[model samples]
Target: MSVFDTACGQVRGSGPDRGVVAVLGIPYAEPPFGADRFRAPRPRSPWAGIRDCADFGPVPPQSAQLPGAPSWSPGDEDVLSLNVWTPAAADGAAPGGPLPVLVWIHGGAYTFGSGAQPDFDGAALARAGLVVVTLNYRLGFEGFGHVPADGADPCPPNRGLLDQIAALTWVRRNIAAFGGAPGNVTVAGQSSGAASVACLMAMDSARGLFRRAIAHSAVGPCYSPELAGHLMEKVAAEAAVPATSAGLAAASPQTLVKASDAVVDAYRQNPHSGRHHWDPVLYGPVADGVHLRADPLAVLAGGAASGIDLLVCHTTQEYWLLDAVGSSAKVTTEEHLNRFAADFGLPDSLTQGYRGLMPEAPVGDVHLALYGDLMFGEYSSRLADAHARAGGRTFLSRFARQRGGSEPVAYAWHCADVPFAFGNLGEESIRFLIGGAPTAADHHLSARMTAAWVGFAATGEPGWEPLGASGGPVRTWDAADTTRAPAPGHWSDSGTVRTLWRSFGYRPLRP
Candidate 1:
């Protein structure tokens, strides 16, 4: 074991053969409880003594309520904690060291997830000569719920995003102590984490904190303020409580979580409502003239962050992991496809285009593919294309390896790249998804992926061509070998899909 005294407090971490690892759970900001609840994060009060960080900190007060998923007890008062894995003490290494830093943000649709998940262990990445850090942030109602018309605070909701910003700030201040280059940081996340990275890219607060970013399965849209406010109103109504600051302050954490769950259930049941789901609260990260000045996609289209290097991509069969109506075996018909498309606001011509391409495929496949393209594939390409057109360095990729022997054969499903990215392929969670243990091929792929990630953090070059450069290609990590080629037509077909996203107010800049 090793220990370090950081600015916020004392942190204890585990060490490996390479060097000492110091995990810091310093509170970058105050707990968003009591009067401060439902408002933007405020700076944490500096502590007097060494605060022990030997164990993982408590997660935010959230629904201890997963129906069938495993559950664990919550922790200490400070739910905002960060875990770090480094090769050695920063002072021990040379100034402006060559070692890169990879800061990971776990994804749970901005609702649930912790950095302590076993699959996120950073030992392997540290062994590969990079520092790895993960953190916990407020979630669910505590992190995203909006205040009433007569709320006490002026900042718009997106407290969770604010927490992320605080974590990055922490990284900037003290990563050097862990033998990391403070200026050479890469922020990466999956799903909502990816969306958060997109938010960071557009957030003025996050500017200059990290030099590069990697967004896996990044969402193309964010909640509009009007939509988010309406959802908050509905949540308040469902809880049979007033939408006032006092009423919310008086509400219990459990009540807020349950109410938010009810809202999600209602939205799922009535997909035609045209309302933002629980994940993207229409009020989340508004163009509030502050935190997020504009929509992420819009900012990218306007050449914002053109100087930040980006590595963005999505998994193949992105929606296969979702237990929604479209992924079911029973929904393998044209009727089902049309219904799903209607719910997703996809055009008939687009549906027909998918059918024409995969004529012999199952209706369920076509249905999933249509929505998948609309939700992930197209948007991912547009992000790469947009950044490239703006003269930023960008590389795109697709995870194509299918976890063998699973019933549905998850084909690079949602979040499938996480374990591989962290080189935790043999962990139990990863084994369950990949069916048994990861083969030798999986280990090789993990090494390549980790190296690419660390390399990008070090020099903003991800071992691939820029999306709009002369080569304009992608590096595909497959079972056979790591290779590069021009992005295939299927991956680069951005025209029609770009139009669809633009309808949602996203303008894609083409090369």
Candidate 2:
């Protein structure tokens, strides 16, 4: 056991397994419940004595039950805590100066996830000579559901985002005590968490908190206040309450969670429910024009994220995970494919272009390809390009590592790259995502991926040339060929998919 002082007080942590001390479950803010419910995070009241924090804290109000991670039952209030993994105080390590810090935000849409998720364990990164921090924020309706303002202290919108910001503020103030450089910090996440990183780049309060960012599979981020309001109404309807702050707040977290899930089921069952039918995820950071100035794409293109060094990554087949897990809508016939295209306002020419690209592919495959790009791939690429064009230091990479060319195949789909990047390929729970046990080649790829992350967090360089709107190297991580990164030459806009989305405008997902 080891002890370290934080702004709150001293904490005892377990570690030095191989030179890393992890201080888990330290409160970064007061729990957002009771008087603080549906509100911005309150600063944590300092503690007086040594707090034993050997295990992870309680998660937020979420319904997700990730394998090998704790699940949320009702009344788990202290969800705004964070964990630190560092070698600064580990056994058998010489004393060193402050190390670069990498703060992680977990991705489970905007509804349910915690820093305790298995893939986010920070020990590997800590071993690579960087202090790693992961945190939990409010999820589901409690964190993101819309509410009416009360007098001068209008309950803030994007309260989940606010919780994340509060955590980062805590890191800025207290990370140095964990042997981290307060001035040097990088924020990283995947899926919705990646979107949060993008939002943080464009946010005023989040400025100066992170000097660099790493976003993998950054899904769309932008929910208009009207859309947010409507979802709240639906949730209220499910809970049998009035669609007001008081009514929703009066309900229990368990009730709200069940209500929100019912609303999601309603959307999932009704094909005409618009975009939410395809993706029933109900909460997101509201672009209320105050906290988040605009949609992430527009904000980044307008240059708000220019000063931050950015690293973007996305898998080649992002939507397959959703399809495999029976989470996404499947389009099989030509009529449904056409309707799917029209649903998102995709151009006929673009659909035809994709057909030309993959003529033999079934309607479902075509739909997945187009839908994945619309939701993740194309959007993520544009973010990188926009940041680069606006004068930000940016790098882009694509994960294409797969299993056997023959038997027992696993596509380089969403989340498959995470465990590899984190170097936890041997874990049993994660093996299902990465397609069974890893091989020597997979281990090599994991090392390279981990090294790239270590290098970028340490120095803002990920072993590839800085990307630009016109041209730059794209580091390709592949197990098939571990000898070289990015293999041969690849273009900045090489694929037909890029040209198809050249002038497309992104809109908020609707119900």
Candidate 3:
């Protein structure tokens, strides 16, 4: 183990590289439980002696819905911690010469997921000459639920986001000892994590925390205050507790989690009823006009994210990973696609536009393609456009690599590109997602993806021209032949989908 001094205390980390070290489970904030429940995070108190930073810290209590999802459980409320990977020793100074930093935020629809998961190991990325850090934040009702707490201590909304800010603050003060330049940090994530990155950009509190940002398949970030209040009421009712911070603090985390799950389950069963204008997974950061005053996309369009270099990616078939929603087989006819579109107040003409784009694709495949756009593609494109229009440099790409045993799912479903980018495709948590065994081509593609990400983090140029507000340009990764060396191709956003996305209201989800 290698020992280093941080703001909080002395920490000893272990790593394989003689020159690389990893410090796991260092708290950035006091545990958000007991007296601290439902409150914004507070900085961790300093420790006296060398702290054993060997095993990962406890992750927040989470509810798992997928069969093979990574376990960040057996955990507790003392989970507002972070892990760091850096070179073992410095080149000149005690901490070492400054290195680029990559801070990853894990995604689980704002309710689940932890930074401690095996899928988020940063050793490989650390080996790529960067200080890699992953951190845990509050999730589900404890992190976000905004109840009316009349005559009680205030329960602030977006406690999870405040937790993230606290972690970043910890990094800024101490990462130099881990060989990272605070001014050169890049915040990145996938799915809801990506949405967090976007929301952070809009938050004035998050200003100057990081220099660059990368978001992968980011969904909507904020819920209407009415919706957030509604969900909190359901949770409060289910848990038989008053809708206030003092009442929730009296309840156990497991009880809150179960109550939250029941609320979402009911919404999923009948999503179209009443004010369920969005999907059940709509619980996230709320537009309380405080932490987040408005829609994040509108904020970005208004130049809230300006001056930060941005890179955003969306997989070709992101929605196909939704096994619960049935596969391409469910949508057999064009009429089916039209009916689905109508549910979201979209026009039947959108399906025709998609059909014209990929005429040879099967009808069900076309449906998957359309759903992909609705779920991830359209939002990502709008984010890119808004950032560019605000004069911020932006880069856009699509991951379309094929796999060996992916017959069950379509091309590059959600998160299929994560392991590749992190150069951890062999991780067991995502083995089922990776399909068959990793291939030589997979490794090669991974190398390129990592190189691009690292390059972006270091120099703010990802080996591509910055995409502007119009004339959309994209870099695509596809391996048509597994035996041959794969190369990324460039193309204009010539597809009609670009126009379609522009025409749509940029809503979170649709029919």
Candidate 4:
């Protein structure tokens, strides 16, 4: 066993090799239970002697949203812990070192997923010569549910975000013991986690915590105070309690979870009439003028992230995976497609534009394309555009390749690149997404992609040019081919999407 001292206390970790050393489940903050519940994250108290940190900690109580989404489990609220994977070396290396740190935040629409999941094991990236850290934060009602402070101890609105910031703060204080340079940190995540990264870049508290960021498929929006208040009341009603921290805090995690599920059920049953018609319940960061000062994308456009290098990417068929999770409806009739378009305040004529873009695709696939662009792809592209326009160094990528597919019309499904980026395609969580066994081509693509990510974390360059340069090239990655091209418009190559997003007040990502 190897032992290292951190600011909080000494921790015993597993033996190390030149390849990797792991120290798992070290608490970064105090348990958020009892009196601590519904409050901002507090520093974890120091321990005496060496504490064994070899096992993963319990994840936060999660609400069941989809089949694989995390759910309530029997555990205390001591979920704010982190796991670290670093290149093995002797103790007392230096005040600063050659290694760069990448802190990973997992995504589950901000409701499910844990940093300790097998899909996110950091050994591969650690073996490639970087320090990797993954952490868990409170989810659902315990994390983002806002109770009216109303002069009482204002229950912190963004406890989950506060937990993440606490973890990063821990890294900055103690990474040197693991041979990592606290000065060269990179924050990276996908989906909701990516949105968290975007939010962090705009946060004053997160300044100087990391020098670079990588956002993959970040589809997040700033929650307004009015929306958060309404959701809180809905959750409280389901729990049969008052809409305040003291009232809701007395409820068990399971009770809170059931309350959360009820709110979602109501939304799923009658979305337009649901209390939260525009926002997802008990998820996302709020623009409460406290933790987050403003809309994340607008802040980036205003140069809040100009000093931070950015690398953002997305899959070609992002919503295809949403279909895998039963999140999309099959468009069987022309009227169905028109209604779907109308829901976005878009012209029914936009359906023809989608069909024109993917002439060979079936109507259902086309519908998936439209939904994907609206929910995720467009946001990611526009974030890159905003960052680049603000003079931030930005590199955009399109993960357009996958295994086990013969037909090739944007087959790179959502969450597909994750395994490739981590160089762990054989993990069970990724098996369903990749279909059958992975091919030699898949392994090759994984290698190149992993190398690029590692390289980018080490330096600000990810083997691609900055966006909006000389034709605005976007580096496209596939198993058999990797090339660059002028911004490819939308994933579906539909002009309708561009116009629709513009109507929604988004500037174009493509030149």
- The total of clashing pairs for model 3 equals 3
* Candidate whose TM-score is highest: 2
Q: Candidate 4: where is the Cα deviation over 4 Å?
A: 64-72, 94-96, 271-282, 347-352, 406-411, 469-471, 486-500, 506-511
Q: Write the per-residue lDDT of candidate 2 for residues 433-506, one digit (tens) a residue.
A: 88888889899999988998989988998887897667477777786432222332222224556877876788
lDDT of each: 0.70, 0.85, 0.77, 0.78
> How displaced is residue 218 in candidate 1, in Å?
0.4
How many backbone clashes are present in model 4?
0
Clashing pairs for predicted structure model 1, backbone only: 90-177, 90-179, 228-282, 228-283
Query: Among all windows of ten consecutive residues in candidate 2, which has the lowest summed lDDT?
Result: 483-492
Query: RMSDs, each prediction?
Result: 4.0, 2.4, 3.9, 3.7
Question: What is the TM-score of each predicted model, taking all chains together?
Answer: 0.89, 0.96, 0.90, 0.91
What's the count of clashing pairs in each model shown? 4, 0, 3, 0
Superposition TM-score, candidate 3 onto the true structure = 0.90
Model 1 compared with the native: what TM-score?
0.89
Better of 3 and 4 by lDDT: 4
**Clashing residue pairs in candidate 2, if any?**
none
Pick the winner on TM-score between candidates 2 and 4.
2
Q: After superposition, how far is residue 63 of candidate 2 from its true place, in Å?
A: 1.1
Off by over 4 Å in 1: 17-24, 64-77, 89-98, 149-151, 271-284, 324-332, 405-408, 469-471, 481-511
On lDDT, who's better, 1 or 2?
Answer: 2
